[model samples]
Target: MRFVRESGLYPDVPVPEVYAWNTTFENPARAPYVLMEFIKGKAFNLVVRDDDPGLLSGLCAVPESQQVALVKAMARLKASLSKPVPFTEIGSLVVDSSGTFSVGPLMAIYGVSLGSPYKSIEDFWRASHEQRLLEKIPNFCARTEESFQPSERFTPHDLMDRYQKLSALIPYFKIPEPYTPLVLHHPDLALRNIFFDEESLLSDDPKVACVIDWSGAQILPLMLASCIRIFRGHRYTGIVVIK
Candidate 1:
């Protein structure tokens, strides 16, 4: 929310203010929560149906000018987030005791129980590719054995060969440079997560009151940081291509 406000993406709009946060709980079952300002606005999806053109025609009764304005607003927001930010390492950001921010392990931000963070993008890509193969090969072998009788089954040597072949291809995979500039991005920026005044729908220039759900927001690679929802129909190559 502070990033959005500091970027000046939505002028005259109020961003939700956070008073406090509690990440600790005495009870294991009880989860942590954030205390923040209450925003009064309907979800953008409730007013506009950009994801569904069929429903958009009937459910989205707003004027064409308003639709154009909404698109422009979204584009401006994307542009604001695309600005480059410097980082010495290729990992998640963390604040230390000295009140200074630095790049830390990715697992620090995405829970330590999940997996360890990589020091370079190539290492991360190689680990991900190998992990996927490790998971799929076992499942594929089980499915193949179950679908056929004993007489049609392949030998253990054949299965090992298949696994070896897949593993050998990992080195040839192309990985992006580890030092790519990180950009601020909201990984989940769907219309359902956006908030706007109900009355704003009637105006020719509708402004987004707030964009909620910043749990997945991060500064990452340009390719990985691009908004999936906004670029569903197109590819984001770190260059703005208006069509």
Candidate 2:
């Protein structure tokens, strides 16, 4: 929220000001609670349906000038939100007692068993692959093992072959090298999180009122930073014949 405010990417938008917070979970009565400024505006999702084709049909329904302005504003926000990572590590950002920012494990913030942060993207990939194969697969198999016949069991060789195939794709996808620049990405950019002034939406100059829900934002490789869910409507045409 501070980053968005400081960037001034959306001048018309208003981010709620946090007045206080309590993270103590030892007592049920003292559980975490965040007191923030109340923002009044309808969610953008109310106007645009997620299943709408081209993701532009709703916008196109408005005046041509408003449509153009909204598109331009969205593009500018995307560019402004992306920033280069200062460190070479792949992890969540943390501020130490000395008041210095540094990279730390995702577990610190999410409290999951994701383990520590990696020094390189390759390390992150390797650890993630291992975790999925070793931990997730086994846990899933255990729950459904009784339903499968003995011959249908997933053998060690099966897992190895799958791992090898995924490993080979690393180079094909062109995963970034160590110390490569990363950008802070909001994985979920659904329309519901965006707020706009309804009056201005159809005016000559459309203005975004605010964008909320910054949870799970992380600095990651540019290749993985693209908003996949939001860009699903965009299509690329190409053909590659692999002999």
Local lDDT at 198 for model 1: 75
Pairs of residues clashing in candidate 2: 13-209
Best by lDDT: 2
Q: In candidate 1, how many Å is residue 17 off?
A: 2.3
Candidate 1: residue 33 lDDT (0-100) = 76
- Please list the C-alpha lDDT of all candidates, in the order they appear: 0.58, 0.59
> lDDT per residue, candidate 2, 76-152, as tens digits?
55555555756666666555555465667744224554555677676777777777777646545655435656776
Deviation in Å, model 1, residue 235 alpha carbon: 14
How many clashes (backbone N, Cα, C below 3 Å) per candidate?
0, 1
Local error of candidate 2 at residue 75 (angstroms): 3.5
Q: Which candidate tops TM-score?
A: 2
